[model samples]
Target: MRYISTRGDAPALGFEDVLLTGLATDGGLYVPESLPHFSIEEIRSWRGLSYSELAFNVMHPFVDDAIPADDFRAMLEETYKEFAHQAVAPLVQLDTNEWVMELFRGPTLAFKDFALQLLGRLLDYVLEKRKQHVVIMGATSGDTGSAAIEGCRRCEHVDIFILHPHERVSEVQRRQMTTVLGDNIHNIAVRGNFDDCQRMVKESFGDQSFLGGKTQLAAVNSINWARIMAQIVYYFHASLALGGPDRSLAFSVPTGNFGDIFAGYLAKKMGLPISQLVIATNRNDILHRFMSGNRYEQHQLEHTLSPSMDIMVSSNFERLLFDLHGRDGALVKDLLERAQQGPVSIEDYRWRHARKLFDSDAVDDKLTCDTIREVFERNEYLLDPHTAIGVRAARNCRRDPAVPMVTLGTAHPAKFPDAIAESGLSIKPELPVHMADLFEREERCSVLENDLSAVQSFIADHWKHA
Candidate 1:
């Protein structure tokens, strides 16, 4: 399977190449040249397969000739074996038709683990075979930093540098990335918001001559095609569990970067009977505004209870816009360039077509807390602020009652205890047994200015030379 840039200027690449070459040279995200479609019978036959088996079935087409079948299966088994739950990604029923898909059971306790774990291993395999070394640069609002570090820490051929907004993340979120001390894993606390950190990463990718051009820079963020490819599997897993293919499923994803819900969009294109895809967001809701009001503009990034979704620029939205504009790369380039200064409206027909399958809502902190409290009182289930937003959106924006509405549980509640405390509940959420001493661990981190040159110099100093 070949991958093509959303902007259509970069050369077409195979799956392995796409995995490492993230954020195309022309400032676009890579998407599959042709999505492999599964027939109803083919999807139905995967009902009772194990998680790894299901993953192999759903993802092997994208793997193509990159890795042999047996080797890829072995790597997949190893990747998911670290998950705390046997089901890898499990579903818990809340109401008659509403449910929560638990995706924080992995090592880092966030939905990102589902993909990052696999991505780390895939990168190691590809880099080892080619005798190459890479530097992974990523920006995180909260969860992606810890998850990416944990995923790639053991890799010998790669060094990972994650930047998060200083003092913006919760204590737990900050420590999760900082406490994992290693020469290979470096954490930077930037004196800015999430969007600032993200912008730095994008700019660095745009011009990697800072690395002296000796080593390639890789991405652990969702801009990497591998991350999105791995995310597509869980949608299939959850839909099949709730009786899919025959019965349509609806997903409400608490998305900031737009990668997770875009995976759902891909699942539907691959013949999963998906009825609705809800774009759930916190106060920093560019995606919500676009879906609900046709305004794809950037505003001041807000710091809410859900820090992970505190983003002004939705990087992956361009991938969807590429499709929404009928895959015209020149048009995408024109629109995105125009959007830099302010908001740009798409054609009416395109917006209307998107609304047919996509609906969105933005929840403020009060509503997030209320939803958490209400769900706990009704179902005796506690939700993190991000998941609370997802549940709220699923409840409010649901179009059909009969269809199963599953909210993607993006993070464990323990990661954001401040939100739990703010919810008026006295219950204290505890970390899993493995992370019981998270607060006790000594953290090592460098506080840096939000300047790209300083960040690049830091990476150059600490990065192991190839």
Candidate 2:
């Protein structure tokens, strides 16, 4: 499949080229030139396949010719073989019509592993063929760092560097990234918010000389189309379980960077029987406000109980705007520039159109903790702080009872032990076998300011011999 940049300035690229280059040269995210569709019969025929088999069938069209069919199939199988659950992503009934899709059964115990595991395999396949090494630099608020590190740490041809705002992430989240001791993995503790770290990563990507002289740099964040493509599979998996288009499904995604919800949008575009995509956000709710037609504004980031969603600027929202504006780069540029300047006005008609497919709600710390306590007491389901926000948002957006609602359980509750404790839920989720002694491990990381020059210098110093 050919991919095009949202900004429409970059040259069109095939899937492999887009995979290797995370962001387009024109400063836009890559999206498929055309979305592939599956007939209803094809969807029904996938009922009895394994998760890996189903993923291969769903994703092959997007990766057309990027990897040989046999190689890609093997990669999918190997990537998911280590999942703790046989079913990979399983659906459990929460109420009569409400269901929870548990997505934290992988080694890293977060939804990101579903994609990052496959990403690592894909990188290995491509790098081995080309005989090249890559340095993957990413910034995460919580889960992505550990998931990326776990995926790329021991790979022979890749070096991964992950940065997070020091002291802003949860204790378990921090440990998950720091505990992994690998020669190829480097962690950075930035003395700022996630946006600061993210900006530094982007700035490094834009530096021509630094990017050329250093080892090849790629990204594992949701900005990479491959990560978003991997996430689209679970949406189809959930839909098929609900009996396909014969019945509709609704998804409640606990979102921060907007990549997760953008996958839902792709699923809808690909003819999934989904009704509403409910975007669950914390107090840092730029997306929520934009959808509500109030204003699209970025304020100072807030450190909340659900620290993962503590983002004021949702990066993947640019991809949504690209589609919303009918793939017109000029219009997308204008909207983004206006948004960056101040709160821009969105017409009521446009807002209503968006509301048809997307419903949004923001949960504060108090409500998030309350929802955690209530769900545990009522249904005996312990939720992490992020998933608690999703449950609350899903409950509020229950406009249709006939359609089954699926709330994405993003991370294992154990990742936020203190938050779970504060919510009065007496549950201690066991750590994954690989991370059982995370707290005892010595961490190795660099401390950096948010300056672009400082980040560039660090890359140049370490990557000179790479």
Per lDDT, the best of the predicted structures is: 1
Every candidate's lDDT? 0.93, 0.87
Best by TM-score: 1
How big is the RMSD of model 1? 0.8
lDDT tens digits by residue: candidate 2, 1-466? 8999888899999987787888888888899999999877778888878999999998999999888899899989998988999989988888988888999999888999999998888888788888888888899999999999988876788878898998889888888898888777788888899999888877666664775664677889899999999999999988888787567899999999999999999988887778899999999988888886647888878889998899887889989888777788777878877887888765666667778999899999999999989988888888889999999999998779888999999999889988887886667777878778888899887888867777766766664254
Off by over 4 Å in 2: 211-214, 464-466
Residue 251 lDDT, candidate 2, scale 0-100: 92
Q: Summarize candidate 1's per-residue lDDT along 79-191 as a digit string, tens digits.
A: 99899989999999999999999999999999999899998999999999999999999999999999899989999999999999999998998999999988888999999
Candidate 1 lDDT at 37 equals 97
TM-score of each: 0.99, 0.97
Among all windows of 10 consecutive residues in model 2, the one with the lowest summed lDDT is: 457-466
Off by over 4 Å in 1: none
